[model samples]
Target: MAKTRTDLINQVLDRLNILVYGQSPSLEDVQRADRIVDGAIAKLASLDIYYVQDPGQAGPSGGAIEDEAFLPLADYIASFHLLADARTQALAQIAEAELRTIAAPARTLRTLRVDPALTPRRYGYYRGGI
Candidate 1:
């Protein structure tokens, strides 16, 4: 699992609450994290994924297809997947930068992973006792 904005936000919030409350999270807050993570995933899917011309633009007329509307959606699928992957990677990087909240990550490990707070990160940024 890669970190997204929600993960980063939750991690930071946890850190802040620890600083302010000098304590751990309640069971309700733990359950709310689960809901927040799921909602972020659902929200992310609504973004427009890619900008490339559609495959259908190849054209039956032999002339170049002109209108963007003529393109097939699948052509954009690869681009969106790529974008999503990149977004995941980026999110991990952001979380990694918040290492003040996690165990000190190794130099090599940092380069090899993003937001270990997620799975690949192993940073233990979660609240329910990683």
Candidate 2:
């Protein structure tokens, strides 16, 4: 089953220890987390490493990323946004590193060609037999 935005927000809140068992987060906090998740998605889209689709709608009830691997990335980013402490920052960094490993950038191979006419022969050798 695909996870929803609420799941992502809850995961982030859990990571930040903002939402504990038997307690629900406030509506304002939930909205804040939703925005944070959107920002995280935007950040990933900006990297161009992955193709992220629009969340379609806005709010915690909106759709979520299908890629399970990217879920943690969103969680870490949202957690950092909720709590920009050194630890959260480090976790975010680690998440990014893991993302790079999961989806390494594509490398294009390039070829170099040299035209004989453009190439210079020996120092004393002339092109026109001069």
Candidate 3:
């Protein structure tokens, strides 16, 4: 199951302690948090660094669980070590840097492979040059 927007918002709120432990969030707060999550996702998407499934579709509460492609990326982003190391930094800042770090290399590689002008020289000759 793919993780939904609500799940992400709850995680963020929980981390911030806005929603206390064992206490459910009110409807208004949930709505507000949902918007925040949307904004964060939009910001990340604009950079093409965050990938997830069914981003806009509605699902059960806390949204749907995350899919395989998204899970690993999410885990890395939410990892305790990285969070602890950047304790003083805002979550958005850390997330942006981390997402960029994970995506920039792949973007570069893709550009290199797709752009003939940027591609590296190859030595071996093939039977059918065409």
Best by lDDT: 2
Residue pairs of candidate 1 with colliding backbone atoms? 116-121, 116-122
> Which residue pairs in model 2 clash with each other?
none
- Put down candidate 2 lDDT per residue, 38-126, tens digits, no spaces: 66777677886454454535566666456655555664565446366777777777777667666765566767788989988857745
lDDT of 3 by residue, 10-106 (tens): 5655665556788877776556555554544565677687654455543325445445434333333333322333542455465566666655554
Q: Determine which window of 10 residues in candidate 3 has minimal summed lDDT.
A: 75-84
- Count of residue pairs whose backbone atoms collide, per candidate: 2, 0, 9
Candidate 1 regions exceeding 4 Å error are 1-12, 15-22, 48-130
Sorting all predicted structures by TM-score, with the top scorer first, yields 2, 3, 1
Residue-level lDDT of model 1, residues 1-130, one tens digit each, is 2223233333434433322455555555444443443233333234332221211211111222223211222122212232335644454444333322233344663545556467663455557854
Query: Each prediction's Cα lDDT score?
Result: 0.33, 0.67, 0.52
lDDT of 3 at 93: 62
Off by over 4 Å in 3: 58-89, 104-130
Which candidate has the top score in TM-score? 2
